[model samples]
Target: MNPKSCLNCGHKISDEFCAHCGQKTDTARITLQSLIKSDILGSIWHIEARFFRTLKHVLFGPGRMAMNYISGKRTRYYNLFSLLLILFGFNVLTLHFYLNLNPDEISEGNSNILEFFSKYSKTILFVIIPMLGTNAYFIFKRIKLNIAEHFIIGTVSLLGILIIFLFNDMVSLVGLWKPAAKIFGILDKASFVLFILFPAVTYWNAFKKSYSKPGLLWRVSVLYVLMGIESLAIITVLYRVF
Candidate 1:
């Protein structure tokens, strides 16, 4: 294969690395090895690193990660949507394994919580409405980030619930079921707050960008509280129907 010229400056290069700007030379070498090492493997490692960085920001700095993402420092971290998808997949995989190991244990626990989740899948998605709606309002009034961007962030918050629940289950091996359940309940509550916090913080940052105060924060927060109630209500309806 002929070496490609630099698209930036049209400088010639013999190998993968462009000597002038040090960019990886784009070429037709999309082979299995090249694709694996270059595309698949490289992206995986990058996403893994981003995922951990996101985790640190979320756990230690609360609201900071979402703010940074809105500030356009996004390439350094996973997009909120990608983070949600990865966490959701992980949650599903681990939850299946954990439940399979001791099916009765999950069923034996607080029947109320289990009943709540099992009942309301669609109503949970309703949270997306107020979430995205407020996002639209803010996007227009503040930083002008699109409404779709807010929806993506809201999706991430929902996925956080799955992640926290799985983390609760996995971390339980070292201790008894009772302690583990208590920890999980607390984490679950926190995850609910996180769902609301993500959008609220993002909107807050958008307002900050436009030299506005966060006066609407509390009203928006009430929308989230209603959304949370809607989530539980949907769960109850589902439990009865299904």
Candidate 2:
């Protein structure tokens, strides 16, 4: 084959792509079709590293993923805070559909907790973040992670819980039928177990990823207990004060 002169530069190219300069030999001038197909879709989906790839990394290695993102190598995964906000909206919306609870029912139900959440969603954010993060900070303090990174771990745990909780809600929806309703009582309780277990599992796995050891289970148990206590306390205060 004849060696072609580089179009971008005067360098002679022996291969399809230039060795000195990274331009391809067959590269064409910029065009609308290439721009729309390659640049636009590539930018939107991040075709190099898809969302599910990122989700897997986040799930399997929550601490590492958060550390990579916090340390500025963020392009491989979704933005943790932004993802929490979006998934939170999906979770709340899914709950609304399943419960079929109207605004009045939410307000006038047995307790004002639902109403408080509706009106003060941001407030709940503040409460949950601190409660979860504080517990993690106390438990994981020996590792030398700062408070903000602890919050990232907290968000990862919450995100895991919310994702599985939404799946539970969908399961209950299908189980709402007459025949399925018979088994829903069992599944309903199971869902509650999942609600607790998903976070517990992820939180433990996160710290486990951070510090590899078998004996961290006891510390995570205490952290989970403290998280549950803080969550219940906040809900109780909101219930009475609302």
Candidate 3:
């Protein structure tokens, strides 16, 4: 128990709920232990519940989860972009560490492997930026959220992709590139399925909430694919030139 105040009207409150404005109350003396017990660990559990719920709807029910999130019904579900960012950053850091430690394991035929990796590193930004921009557009159009919210979400998603790529590249340096490539092919197929499923589901719910049609919704998927290919092309050209 701690001193509490109304987050809404700044009224002091003793109970969990504020009476003056009928809003929730927040405790002031939050400790690290309390945070782990309440917010961090709790958020993780809550997010897990929300993730499964969203996944169910995202895979089969269609557009329901996004619609609920946009409607201010957030209680359990993970913040979409935050989840992506955590995963992405973790992947990238792990990959970077692995690559640096075992550079010789990455390639046998190429003495210029380091140069190759360095030269083409910038290509990732080209892919990520366009994807973020496109996702922002789709989020804005579908959810009617402001640009700022979409921008945050888009940034997280792009970070996730970058992490995946970094992981892939790092695996190449571990003498695992050949097998990893095959595994990645499988992942690519899986991602394609999810990519199609999520946007279509979100778009369907967007239609219900915002009354947008499916025809226009296809643009989001197109943009996603196009950005990916364009990024790959940029990398290829960079490799050829240098």
RMSD of each: 6.3, 5.8, 7.2
**Best-matching candidate per lDDT:** 2
CA lDDT of each prediction against the hidden true structure: 0.59, 0.70, 0.57
lDDT of 2: 0.70
Candidate 3 wrong stretches, greater than 4 Å = 1-14, 18-67, 79-85, 97-105, 108-146, 149-221, 224-242
Best by TM-score: 2
Candidate 2 residue 1 Cα shift, in angstroms, is: 22
User: Higher-lDDT candidate among 1 and 2?
Assistant: 2
Q: Write the per-residue lDDT of candidate 2 for residues 1-242, one digit (tens) a residue.
A: 77888888868898879887878787677689978876687567674365667667765666566656657787777776777777778877876776683333444554456656776666665566677777777787777878887787777766666666667767777776768876876877887887677656666655675655655777777877887787788777776877
Candidate 3 on 1-242: residue-level lDDT in tens? 66576767878788868889876565557799989987899879876887666445434533455445656766656566665555555555665676676676568677466567655655554345455555646644645676554444444344434444544545444434565667665665665555434434444444554544565466556655765677678777877787
- State the lDDT at 63 in candidate 3: 45
Better by TM-score, candidate 3 or 1: 1
Q: Which segments of candidate 2 are over 4 A away from where they belong?
A: 1-32, 47-49, 70-72, 101-122, 182-188, 209-214
Q: How many residue pairs collide in each prediction?
A: 4, 0, 2
**Pairs clashing within candidate 1:** 119-235, 119-239, 120-234, 120-235
Instruction: List the candidates' TM-scores in order.
Output: 0.58, 0.70, 0.47
Q: Give the least accurate 10-residue stretch of model 2, judged by summed lDDT.
A: 101-110
